[model samples]
Target: MFLRRIPSTIFGIITRSRLSRTIMSESPAKRLKTSPRKIGTHNGHFHADEALAVYILRLLPEYQDASLLRSRDPAALEECDIIVDVSGVYDGTKHFDHHQRTFAETFSAEYKTKLSSAGLIYKHFAPALISLRLNQPVSHPSVELLYQKVYKEFIEALDANDNGINAYPADVAPAFNTGGITLPSMVGALNPNWNTPVDQAGEDALFLQASKLMGETFARKLDYYISAWLPARDFVVDAINKRFEHDKDGRILVFASSIPWKDHLFTLEKELGITEEGNKPLYVLYSEGSKPGWRIQCVPVSKDSFESRKPLPDVWRGVRDDALSEVSGIPGGVFVHASGFIGGNKTFDGALEMAKKALVM
Candidate 1:
């Protein structure tokens, strides 16, 4: 959940100055002959998708010095190298517009909804873009994992919104009435109010403002996946491979070090052929390095679910040390939560034993 925003100072005006100097100092023949690439999107109102699309383009080396043209004029769009969201034509390359009536493109066959400019650009460029940013090899498993992870976790929502996909059924009550701030909603808020007296220039300024917001959000999301999330996946995968070393049936997993494993656990289960209920691990044990010893936690049914696939024995609930040890007939017992979701022990072996006893119960 830790996302580091792509600082406005880095991708904003400061880099613009450096880019200008680099272009200006080049030989007169090279500099004067070639026109700077211009990135085009519509003027007036903006959305998170287009703003994010623009930001994605700027991350590449080629478009670093590219001019941003916020215009509806076809003549202006013709001069630009890449026209996004405004142009009404998608060629799967230079022109990426999703607003046309005939457009029916998606990121993959698994998705039914059409892609917006954000998804379009991300689908085409994100793998390389992420690899370049993180300094990881493009072929790295982490890069591809992060690419899909970012889309599923972040960019997919933008595509859905831009395509006018209703998240809730008409009859269903919303879980959150009004307080949630989605990216599209945030971008929409930056538009000039109906009552406000603003010219096209003012609208253009607001468009840039929206891009800054989207840019920071996109950067932070990417940063989190690259720096924090990908490593956690690797840790989880390794734990899955060595599950049997801890127990006979491989139904209890033990981690040498603590890491975020919840998100990757179920997905790894299916991939590792631990699909059936009997084949899967009932609980996870990890060294609680910062605390006394180890933690034994019930495995959740799924990522968004609070329900455990198999919770600890009900007798262990809310019990501590001596009482828990006496009740369970195991030593080095520490404590178990009231909900039976988690328990702790004074040793790794004790924690593993706790999880095993629960499995039999």
Candidate 2:
């Protein structure tokens, strides 16, 4: 049966009441304020630092929908909630610019180079930015770890470039330079070329393009740390903690699963007070990737160093299978790397035994 439609006057009253109630329920911050928040930067050439700085600010709740203003006019920027890179003022609160003569800000005391807009925002807002992006608490260990890692891996280079600080001394030539295609260089390239007509509108479009590029790079790198790198560190930590269970002397560590463990291994060893002479790791036993056996790897003296603390027996280098078994008197022998840094066996027990034997030799 078709019901009669409600009177138009009554429907309007009900609709208005519900709308008013909904508006009242929203918190002041969540409600559409009188004006959108504003972020101000320079009008001309774009750089990775300010582009990234804008991206980080937008990641936070307060500035998600903020308007960006690029202009050198003081009056235009004065209305912005935050001014970056062009304000010539750095109070460590809102305005962040490193170009001023008196500006002497750094992300940390460990770094000598002055900070750029990217480093400035990261230093103060990293915990919140990371927490918001990853949906993790600001105080989470991962957040704290990533806060430092992101700067070291991504933001530091931008800061150095913006500050005109050379990564190496002037005397030493760089091993390789990508013809200045670094992140900062790429962002700067987004700016209109010298031959192009200068227009505020053109520069603004370039700024947006640069911001998108910087934002994507930050996101991809952060995800790698959170998803792949962090999980591997857990395995490394567990292996380091239980090292003695595999070897009575605690000189050999075993990982049940394969992982990227070199960096974590060296770092954890020092943090766990295992850096002493006998306590230091000499070998690592772990499963091989895409294979059916285990590997015995000699721990390197340093992450970058080619020298291993204790290489496999000389007879095992470049040897395999029956020959290796015959030389070492160990069963299930597989190939040993020519460098003597790693060897493998058909079983976990066999690989562990290989490490133990190498330890003595």
Q: Distance (Å) between predicted and true CA of 244, model 2?
A: 1.3
Q: Per-residue lDDT of 1-361 in model 1, one digit per residue for the tens?
A: 1112223444434345545665677787886555456788888678999989988887665565568878888987888888899888999778999988999898889888689999999999898877766667889887888888899889999999988898778899887668657878989999999899688777877777788888878877787776677778878877778888877778887777777788788778777777778878888988887778899988888878779988888988999999999988889989999999999899988888888889889
Error of 1 at 264 (Å): 2.9
Model 2 Cα RMSD, 1 decimal: 9.8
lDDT of 2 by residue, 1-361 (tens): 1111112132123233443464567788766772357888888778899988887776555565578888888988887888899888998777988898988887778888789999998898778866754567898888988888788888888889988998878999788866976888888888898998766766777778888788767767776776677779988887777888877888888887677788788878777777677778899888886789999988889987899998898878999998998888889999899999999999998998898888888
- Candidate 2 residue pairs that clash: none
> After superposition, which runs of candidate 1 have C-alpha atoms over 4 Å from their true positions?
1-35, 134-140, 320-326, 329-334
Question: After superposing candidate 2, which stretches have Cα over 4 Å from the reference?
Answer: 1-29, 133-136, 320-326
Pairs of residues at least 3 apart in sequence or in different chains that clash in candidate 1? none
lDDT of 1: 0.81
Tell me the number of clashing residue pairs for each predicted model: 0, 0
Worst lDDT run of 10 residues, candidate 2, spans 1-10
- True-vs-predicted CA distance for residue 169, candidate 2, Å: 2.1
- Residue 321, candidate 2: C-alpha displacement in angstroms: 4.9
